[model samples]
Target chain A: MENPVQPLEGTTSKKVFWSALASGFLTLGLLLVSFGVSGVAYAVPIAGVGDFYVEFDKLVGKGYTFYPKMGKTSSSDSAPQGTNIIETLTIDNLQLYKDFQVGGEWIRVKITASKPVQISGLQHDAGLIEANAKFENLVLEENNSSDWQKQFQQTSSTIVLENAKLKTHYLFQKTINMNGMKLTVERIKK
Target chain B: MWWKRKFMLICCSLALLVSSAGLFSQGIKAEERDTEGFIIEADRVVGSGMTASLVTRETSKNDGKPMLRFQYNSATIYGMKLTKQVHSDKGPVSITLKAKGPVTVYGMTVDASAISFKGACVKATETVPALGMENVVMVAHYMKSDDSVIDQLTLNTVFGSVGPKKPGQLKVLQDLAGLPLEQLKKEIARISAGHLPLTCEDGTASEDLSGPIGLIPNPLDEVIGGVTNPLDPILQPLDPVVGGLDPVLDPLKPVLDPVLDPLKPVLDPIKPVLDPVVGLLEPVTKPLGPVLKPLEPVLKPLEPVLEQLEPVVSETTEAVEKTVQTVCQQVQASGGVITKELGLVLIDEALAKKVPLNQVCPTNSSVTSIVVKLQESLLNTLGLGNLLGKLIPSDPMEQLRKMREEIAKKPDGTVIYKP
Candidate 1:
């Protein structure tokens, strides 16, 4: 007799492993479907749902090339003084949504942007990431400025999603008052 | 012991899985649920056209004071409503943020025309853009309350580009132009009993006729009629001639000099003895040296007596004249003996004047007394008392006899009948 609980333990262990594997597969499946749908043209994600920002100086006519390194200050005089080193922001992923499913068949589209990017003026006091765009009607998730510079959020505003698909002239008029802020559209995954 | 440890491990793993699943579910649930902190409403655009109005019951905090601030009230673009707890410690504190309302925003971007904070406010910023639909004037009136006190300040805003676009503006101008004409007519009727014409920039009938509504007529016009004043040009007194001269004229000096010189011959060498015959009676004819003169002293006592006698004389004269007139009138009226008697009495009165009173008076009295007696005698001759006594003979027979005697001594010897 080789310990009576051996086979029983093995069977139970096998069941547990299989279940964990199944759960993992299900998560992967959901992610793959979302990725596939995101590949569709002119699609932007509804912003205010997550903590993310994107900034770009050049307007995207078609395709774009993104640099892995942080952007440099356009004006050398405005560069931070002393040992204050510029922090880098990591843009893990990028996607676009035109009419993505919110819940049921009711689909809502948003002009969105991915990749956490800081505004040019806000580079000195890092910790701010902005992305913005305009559409007919936009519903935001949250705008919390609790943690800002000196708790003094020197950052102008952090936009979650920016829709380049919107009318350029109209967007300025109806949406954002971009007095000194620079905006950029990120490249979608091919 | 190993088996027991494995069992514990499995139990912990199961628990962790269940908790993670629960957490995910809660997250999804939160997404679905509406937030109480979030507010939404409608705001009116105020203007001559469509106006956006906002009315709310919300509160906020300002400067450590519990201030009711505007968050996302009626159409957050126009005004703000307080939805969550806002805290401010120091410095000029204002937490004005925009929140979405019920209405769906359409087109490119929707910027507010203006943002105003009312009640207890530190500072309010306003940006009047096209927040609502076009042609709609947006008014964002914010009333914030600080420390339980609320003061309302309204921000009125209008939309539309610069310059006039509609026909209505032209109508306004036309109406303004017509105003003066109507005013002119009203002023004309109001001034001068509808007689004087209007005298504004738009002419008048004649400036001369126009007087203040109720004023004394111009002395110039009344004195020298017509508008072409005679005193205007010709015949006007010289300004230097009349200016500042004294108006008094002395009574001592003659206005003009006497015509003749004092040295001129004054004699008229008359026909000397041509009337020698007239010199004989010159003594008689010469004035008796005021024959009543020596009588003046004697008459001094009689002055009052004379004054007293005057009324008698006047009354007698009036009575005599009245009696004579009455007698004559009666006689003329009757054409009988009464006329003859009145005529004779009048003649006797006239004759008494030719003879001096001194010559006619009895010499027992003084000269003045004699004059008085003659005057009294003249009254008797006039038959005034006799006539009056006869008309009303209610007197005693002795009085009648005296009156008859008075009537009998007349120079004409006229007989008077006593009643």
Candidate 2:
């Protein structure tokens, strides 16, 4: 009876090992197929900056502030204290959504704002964003401060960019959760 | 082993679910929404708190359906504001306020303190009610309704007026719209009797309206009557003149018949002889017909070329005539001897004056004829005519004469005498 029980346990161990190996192969094959077809599962997320200062020549969506207490309090802060301030806003193209429904009635809402827009202090969270971007005369500065949050509280952060353009569909102050996201930067062939 | 199988199944299911979600997300990203019928463009447009003037024009699509009932050419709104508030005791409430300038609808321009709009749904089953207007003043230079034209309109709550641009135009429009209905039915009854008295309202009778409209007297008919009415007096007097000449012609016919009767007897014998001559010529012409038939197609393309050259040929002929007159006057002033050296000098003078060589001494010009005759006389006087005549054959001389005759017959200068 001891010999029979040892043989049974050995058989069960061999079956379990084969099952695990097969499952690993199946999962790897599925991952490969999905990555090959969708081509978006390999993107790296962007880490948040401490001071959160950015400057672009054009931005095409709404702007809002998450930390109202740290906002600018100078005389030039034209907007209400907590609200986001746009320095020089220009809207190039506006499209009305004809079929937008609200409370069982169609309300004409202009939803699409295309290009030639400018704003200051933009905060955004996007699951996926595709853009044709150009960066000119870019300079990166690193703060040596140990306490990064203290820098924002001391002064209003200012970044100046010249002749920069970024075209994407991501909106400010909106969070989207997508299965996968891809960021591809390819040099245009003349 | 049972736990390992369950684990494997769960892993496979998770893999399938993730891949399916990826594919579905890709599809959603790639999908494009359809926006048809309407397009709006503006220099500056705000999503809310928009204040701008609007100019709208009505137009139809190629399929005879209204694409956009109203198209705004310059409707830009800026600085829109919307506010929303909520209380613990009460629910939330929202308010939107808009301020617009002058609005142009169709051909009328309206200035109002407040204007409201109701946008219709895309489906035909739904209808949107119109919002009311306040303190509106509509001014139109010209307003057209149905087929009638209102020249100038100024409408307000207190005063309104409509009239034609000219005094007589309103009467003309009234007559044109009203007369056709009753007159067309009467004319149709007279033209096609026993058929149902043609009603203008019927579908088939509408097609027959063109017949009555064609019969309506136009300016061209009045112009024709104006031209023929004056001729009536002149033509009436000629009728009596013709009647008075008929008696004089009758008396002469009786007297001339006696003499003409003897001539007819004399001329009757020549008719048989001429018939045979005409019969002999027919065979020659019959064969020429087939030869000429093939040339029609070849000459048809040349007709336009010849027509285009006609004016140029006439202008060239006039230039040649002018040049010959000038040259002849100079030659006659030089005593018409036309020595070879003198001829060369005259040609150099004409060239200096920018006269074309062909026009200076055109091939068959009277000046050229006189110059040739003088040259020939000079050669004969110098005793060289016999020697030159011996070198050139007489056939060439005869051909030259024939070419000169052909050029003289067509004096428009279109022909080029090769000889």
Leading candidate by lDDT: 2
Ten residues in sequence with the least summed lDDT for candidate 1 chain B: B149-158
Give the docking tier of candidate 1.
incorrect
Q: Which residues of candidate 2, in runs, are more than 4 Å off?
A: A1-91, A95-108, A111-130, A144-190, B1-419
Real contacts retained, model 2 = 0.00
lDDT values, one for every candidate: 0.30, 0.34
Fnat of each prediction? 0.00, 0.00
What global local distance difference test value does model 2 have? 0.34
lDDT of 1 by residue, B1-419 (tens): 99999999999999999999999999987543321122212243211111121112121211111111222222313332222111222111111122232222222121121222111111112122222221222121122211111012111111111211111111212322344545634532343233221111122322232433112344676766864676577545666565534342433234333323332332222334445556756765556647867877888898889789979988987886676445334433432332234534433433443433233223334433433443355445554355444422333333334444555565563423221
* Residue pairs in candidate 2 whose N, alpha carbon or C atoms collide under 3 angstroms: B48-B80, B49-B80, B49-B81
Error of 1 at A83 (Å): 36
Chain B TM-score per candidate, please. 0.15, 0.17
Give the runs in model 1 whose Cα sits over 4 Å from its true position. A1-12, A34-190, B1-419
